[model samples]
Target chain A: MDADVRQMTWTELAALCTNLEKACTKQLKEEEARAFASLASFYASKRKAQGDASLDDLLALIEADLSTGYRSANEAANYADDRGAKRALLWGEKATKLLKSLLARYAKQKEALTADTGVFVCEICGFVYVGQQPPEVCPICKVPSFKIHEVKKEAI
Target chain B: MHAARNLRLCTKDCVCLFICPTGATNTETGQIDFDKCLDGCRLCVDACPSGAIYLVSSTYPAPQPKHPSVLETLYSLVRSKAAQEDVAHSVKEGSDDAALRQICTVVETSSRIIAEDLWRESGYIIAQSEATRALLKAMISEHGTMEGFPRTEVEELLSRLS
Candidate 1:
């Protein structure tokens, strides 16, 4: 797995991780699950070895591209004078802002944060909030406490 | 093009109402009536105190499809994200921990959204790809035989693409 991943370019590896991400979301057959596990391990191993390499930057760039959807949606809404489209874009913009904020926080505190500290993400909107406990209500998506989930910062 | 209000951001200052020449900006709904709005008039957009109003075009030109390689990469990502979402769903099912369950659900939802976004970017969405024209043509030919298919719209798009 290591040798295979090593042979690929950083872009290719990133693409693999991205594809794996989507594949993991769908209902997986046992064979696919094993394949996913192998790929996930390979990705993790590569990232650990590379340490702040181009792959890391590529992932960030990919995540940041979520904003493009908001921009286009807003433009479409404006063109057609569609209030529903605009409202959907508004939610999307809020979610994007939350993602940016979470990323910024993670970057700023990467050095200071310990393994024990919790990173909460809102289930309804994917809003990442770093702290011991999730917020009472997600500021972005307005999901309640039951909807907030704590994840390892590394996993996020 | 005309100005419209995002009511969520509107502070109800009524500056848009004051600035709009055609009285398109209304206090009741805190929205601009598109029928009454003057084309290319942006007075309300410029004068909105809360920055809630902005001008937008009524229609946009067809967007060129991205490079084939870029489109392929996006499609690959869409599948990848779907895979991850499945993993999250499975984890959510077994987890007794509330926070963990919540996190898994969120991951699943977000991954799906990302996957859909990539799919849209991968030359499948209308107004963003010539591939859409082809797809429309194929779908109409295959499915239009069933009934209720908007064969006319598909025909128009095919002609436009040609």
Candidate 2:
């Protein structure tokens, strides 16, 4: 019998999360394309909410980034490398960068993301960006700009 | 750090097996023997043609505990993503379009990832609070009679917590 999630060790949780990421990667590649509009929206809203929430200010968000965000990215990166999936590795790296950048900006008393800087999303690897244009080559998946879409950041 | 082989990408070229100084790669199970692997030796990682071998860190960084308020925010996000995932799953079920299915799958995957992050940081695993105890007790009550619930492990966990 499988142990309950709460009872499982950190290693078990890591393995399960890695399997989830690997399965997600397989689906994206086999389908020949991908879409992350809903996922991206979910994350953007979460980030915005964290920024707006008054519970202990940015400390809560910073702590979460240090604990959950960084660890998740590490697990995903290792799993992606093991599975030989460059796209998955890139997405994990992006997640780590997002967390670090947020922490840095918040520490300096600046907004992590500005209203004018648009969100550029990679269709293949779900890498999100706030920039003037999509990158020449996606750092995560190495895909060209054609595969990256400029998403609306007005609401977020 | 020592090299570990990813069997999925391993072409059975035996490159790692030949390159490993400690014979850690020439195992019956096809996995490198971590105990025998030399520290900082990445010979197999470099020699592998398929890029399957990579160095893994044996020691993980210390856990940074997040504040409960942060956990609350994460829980809210998890709930939102979970609801979105449910909607996408339903849409995928109802639609015949391949594109829709693919989109739904991506949504579902991302939602799961977010959910897992919340779960990890929620203090649900450490038995540190009443909430964790309550959750375990509830699970025991609900699935204690079920055959596949790992009742013994659950009971053991509950006992230790108590």
Candidate 3:
């Protein structure tokens, strides 16, 4: 299994896990389906951790990128020819703002927050919600609860 | 073109089993054998009750070139997402709590998905395309020296795409 996994690309492995989970669910094997889902997440984490970058370096890089994204979004929004394009760009700008604020908060309160609260990200708009449960609807994009994915420390 | 099945939408209707002339639709493996599948034969695609089956083109159009500024922003965004994935991994490693670890996994996965999307947007739409190959080569030469860059994986991807 390890040899097979090592040979497969991350995308292929993810697809295989997703299909396996679906098969298990179709067979009414709920526990096995959940196990496969967890396995998928675990493998994803393992792949993401392959490099030697320190957490601080990653945080710093993200901060710089977010700042750049914010600036570009603002520029795009200003020049957008159509109202719809401008609105969408503005939404992106707002999302970047939210992400920057979240990153700042996380940096300052990492230890305390990691102890109890889980981070939930809105899949639609990148809104970060730090709490035991995500809001009923995303405040930024108005997506329903199911769209808010919880980020935990480990797979169940 | 060959038939493909989306496992999520497949309803076990078994219509494809009978519709496929080459017996390419195998439910046991949950895959449609591309070699066996007849080109332009979309019987299964039309027959699947749940609309799970579809035809994929064997050839892809050339990727349109992205604007320089757009590519720059996308590259930065991709880097950001990649870094976030690493941060999630680090957080997951630092914690022993099962729930927290699970959340970290979600974070990592989300970052990866976003990075892939950014790559797709930057004209890397077809894995076998020359544009994708050029982009991968450029990434290897440009960012390969960066600390903690996934140089090996990028090289492997370039070889595969070649």
Error of 3 at B54 (Å): 1.0
Query: Model 1 off-target regions past 4 Å?
Result: A1-127, A130-156, B90-100, B124-162
Tell the DockQ for candidate 1. Answer: 0.05
lDDT by residue (B29-71, candidate 3, tens digit) is 7978877999998999999999998887756677665555555
DockQ for each numbered candidate: 0.05, 0.04, 0.16
**DockQ (model 2, Cα):** 0.04
Q: Which predicted model would earn the best DockQ?
A: 3
Clashing pairs in 2: A90-A140
Give all candidates' CA lDDT scores.
Answer: 0.51, 0.49, 0.59
Off by over 4 Å in 2: A1-156, B1-3, B6-21, B27-30, B34-61, B95-99, B117-144, B147-162
Query: Which candidate gets the maximum TM-score versus the true structure?
Result: 3
Q: What TM-score does structure 2 among the candidates reach?
A: 0.39
lDDT by residue (A27-69, candidate 1, tens digit) is 2222333433443344334322222222234235436445454
Q: What is the lDDT of candidate 3?
A: 0.59
Tens-place lDDT per residue, model 1, B71-125, is 4334444444544455555555555555445444545556555444444444333
List native contact recovery per candidate, as a fraction of 1: 0.03, 0.00, 0.19
Reference-based TM-score, model 1:
0.45
Best by lDDT: 3
Q: Chain A TM-score of model 1 versus the true structure? A: 0.51
Q: What is candidate 3's DockQ?
A: 0.16
lDDT over C-alpha atoms for residue B154 of model 1: 44
